[model samples]
Target chain A: MDSIIEVSGITKVYQKRKTKEKIQAVDNISFQVKRGEIIGLLGPNGAGKTTTIKMICGLLKPDSGQILINGVDNEKHRLRALTHISAVLEGSRNLYWRLTVRENLEYFAGNRGVSRKNVASRVEDLLQKFRLKDKETELVNRLSRGMQQKLAIAVAMLADTEVILLDEPTLGLDIETGYEVREILKAIAKEENRTVIISSHDMDVIQDICERTIIINQGKVVTDDRIEDLLKLFEVRSYTITLGEHLNEKQEHLIKERFLDYQYESNRIQPKLSVELLKTEDIYQLFDILKLNETPVEAIDREIIQFEQVFMKIVKGETTNGVDQVKSQSV
Target chain B: MEWIKSNLNLFKANFRKETIELRRYLPNTIAMLLTVYIIFMAMFAGIHSVGAPGTVDATIQNTIVNYIFWYLTITIVNGQGYEILTEATRGTFEQLGMSPSGIWRILSARLLAQGILTAAMMIVLLYLSMLTTGQSLNVDFVTIIPIFLLTCISMFGLSFIIAGLTVIVKQIQAFLQIFQFVLAALTFVSLSRAPFLVFFPITKGVDMIRAVMVEGLTLNELGFSNFLVLTTNALVYFIIGLATYLYCERYAMKKGLLAHY
Candidate 1:
């Protein structure tokens, strides 16, 4: 697929107010978002996710490199780039509390240089689609948080831009509203066929709406691949082996050398060895270690991994020597 | 033609939004207008209590012109700056910055809308003040409109400067509070007494407005050099103010200030 947004080697640095110490918020990060593809940008706190989002939105200028929206360089042509993109940076806070729902739509559409008369039909369609038709004339602050959030997203959609960047679209939302937001996002992607880059800590939203996930850690892109591939990779690489007897010293040493990251449960009734292999065939090496002391393997279970766990493990730097070494998506 | 259409739409959008907000926040709107009236009344009361009874009528009329321009100046400049502060606090300012028409254009449109609304209120206040003082100077809007509009251009320029600072610092309330008095000084101080004030934003326009409203001067009577000064102040200050605003915007973006308070 052709890329709709190209962020190339972008870096952002900040200075501490008193000491003037330089902190690199984003360190040489780069990613390409395909047209009509929904991608998740996941990271921990202070992990440069907001910095990258602001850069993409043209609200913040990166110290180095370039961001191109529809082949237009954002830094050099920020306004023109904005013509092709819009964002809901703070969800409900993005709206005018004093303005009504319909007024907010018209106002934001106007901001994008589209007249209210021109977008009147589109606004009605969005209000109906987002289930906000009944509350069109209600003040934004009077609306429920879910409705406010939906209006914010509706405002973004009204811009009619190709790419929409939503930072924490579901933040501070209740479960049902969060679910509703997720559904709206899914519908937006499917119906509009627009490229969407979402930054969220909610793993479920990412897993449900995004085909690809980019995990950032310590100001670098650690893992960028398919969400399903990551789930399957993490699932297949993990194995739990139950031994009939405790492992001898040689077997323990061999297991530790072969699998740097594993759980040894000798204290339990059955000595179980939980290890993740770099490759599926590495299970043979584990078998060799088990045979050294005639350690009888009673059962071998492959541990199933959830996307949240996959995200956690990737972000915690746990995948560095294991999966990261083999795949090496990090820069 | 497309540029004209989009910008017109942009202006209409903000203009309607501002008008709707004014209507929705009717109590606050009334309070703002009343506050100016109350202040003018107090000034009128002062003129009555201690005065040369012979010059009382002229003094009241002059005070009315000064107070009217002060109202326009304060609301035109500080209103937009207050908006910047509020939007920054509420996190909506960045949304304005995200517009394709650009923040500067939106702000310019918003400032114009605000100026028009304030002008309407100022007219009502002028009539009320005249009724209260029972000393009408001149109600000639034909002469006053051109001067008021030109002065508003300079005021818009000053507003852009305030907007630039507010977006970057978000804590310029103290400066704005003190600046209102400075605007008062500009509106109250005459041209012949301080000729150099002509170069400053809004000062020339206000002096010209004072001439038109208080002295009943026509456009031709204002002459070539004075009109030149007025036109130059409007254009020069507007260009300078917009440039300063854009520069501060670039600085804010570099410092990542747009997203935070």
Candidate 2:
């Protein structure tokens, strides 16, 4: 697939007002969104997701490096390149609060120089698609937050841009509304043949809607891969072992020595062990420790690590050894 | 042609929004009209009580003109730019920035809406003054119309400057308050009968308009020298305003300050 949006080596630095210290908001990040792909940009708070999104949509000029949209340099011909992109930054902040939903849609369409005849049809289509027809005449400020958010995305869609950038689309939303927004985004990505770059902290939204994710931490990209691959990679090494009896002091020390990280709960008679293996043979090492004590294993199940936990581990820098392990396994 | 098309659409959309918003503040508009009427009535009554001096009519007319100018300036500076600055603070500037239209078009549409609303208010005040005072009509239409248009453009230019400053400066509400005081002082000092003040641009515009409206000076009578100075002042102020706005735009882009409120 052709790359619809290519961000290369972008860096954004912000100067503190009082002390004048330079803060790196986005540091040397590069990523690509293929045509018709829904890519999630996931990170903790203050992770430069917003800065990267702003740079791509031409809201902020990066300190260095280039962004190309549809093979056109975004900085050189910003207007032309922006013609292929639309953004819903911070959700309802992009909307005209005083204007009605339909009016806002019409206004943005008219600004894009769409014909009057086509504007009505386009606005109607968006209203229907976003399920906002009942609130078409209501002022944006009067609508519920979820309705306002839906209208915002619908307005971006009205521009018919090839790429849509959504910054925290489901932030601060109720669970039901968040799920509704995720479903709407999923539908847009699947049915519209449009490329989407979503910056969000909602792990479920990313896992369900996005095929690939670019995870950032402290202004740098830690991992960028397909969602399936990340899940599978983290899953294989994770296991939860249920023991038949508590381990002795020596056995506990040995288990702790064998595993890179483990959690121990002493209250339970049958101790449970959650372990992440670095090597395939490490499982035998765990078994050997249990065998020495004649410990009965009630059950040992391979744990499926959720994307949220993987995200936490990646941000905490546990993935460096994991990457090394993967390299050795491939060799 | 494309610029015109885009600007016209922006103007229409923005004007609609402004109209809707202003509708909610109808009480303020009503109060303003009443105040204009009462102030003109009081001025007319005072002039009548002063035995209808030869300069009384001119003085009253000048006062009314000053009032209208300051009223419009305060509204534009305080109300219109306040809305724009609030939007900027809320990150709505990014929405406007991402649109196909240029910043100049957005600014122009806003100014156009302000101009129309100001003109409407001025006309209503003029009619109310005429009805109450029955002031003699001596204004030269040819010169007065052009002068009025220039004054409107000059005020619009100032409004743009204020909007641009609001983008760069953090505390715009305080700045706007200071601007209101400065504008009041400028209007008062320039329109007053002070010989040394004639060199100021505000004084020049006011004196020229007063001469045409009160003294019944025709274009030929005013001479090319007077027209040259008035137009030059208006043009220079307009150029300075545009230059300031361009500088602000570059600064905003460089500093990422466009959405900084």
The fnat of each candidate, in order, is: 0.86, 0.45
Candidate 2 backbone collisions, by pair: none
Tens digit of per-residue lDDT, candidate 1, span A1-331: 8898888999999987799999999999998888899999999999999899999989999999999999999999999999889999999999999999999999988877788789989998999999999999999999999999999999999988899999999999999999999999999988999999999999999999999989888788888888888886666577899989999988888888878678899998888899977778898998888888888889989877789988887876665324444233521
The stretch of ten residues in a row with the least summed lDDT in candidate 1 chain A is A322-331
lDDT of 1 at A299: 96
Model 2 CA lDDT for position A205? 88
DockQ of each: 0.84, 0.46
The alpha-carbon deviation from the true structure for residue B222 of candidate 2, after best TM-score superposition, in angstroms, is: 4.3
Q: Kindly report, for each predicted structure in the order presented, the TM-score of its chain A compared with the true chain A.
A: 0.87, 0.91
Model 2 agreement with the true structure over A152-194: per-residue lDDT tens digits: 8998999999999998999888999988998999999889989
The local lDDT score (0 to 100) that residue B169 gets in candidate 1 is 89
Considering chain A alone, report the TM-score of candidate 2 relative to the true chain A: 0.91
Cα lDDT of candidate 1 equals: 0.87
Q: B170-211 in candidate 2: lDDT tens per residue?
A: 467877877787777656565445766544435566667767
Clashing pairs in 1: none
lDDT of each: 0.87, 0.77
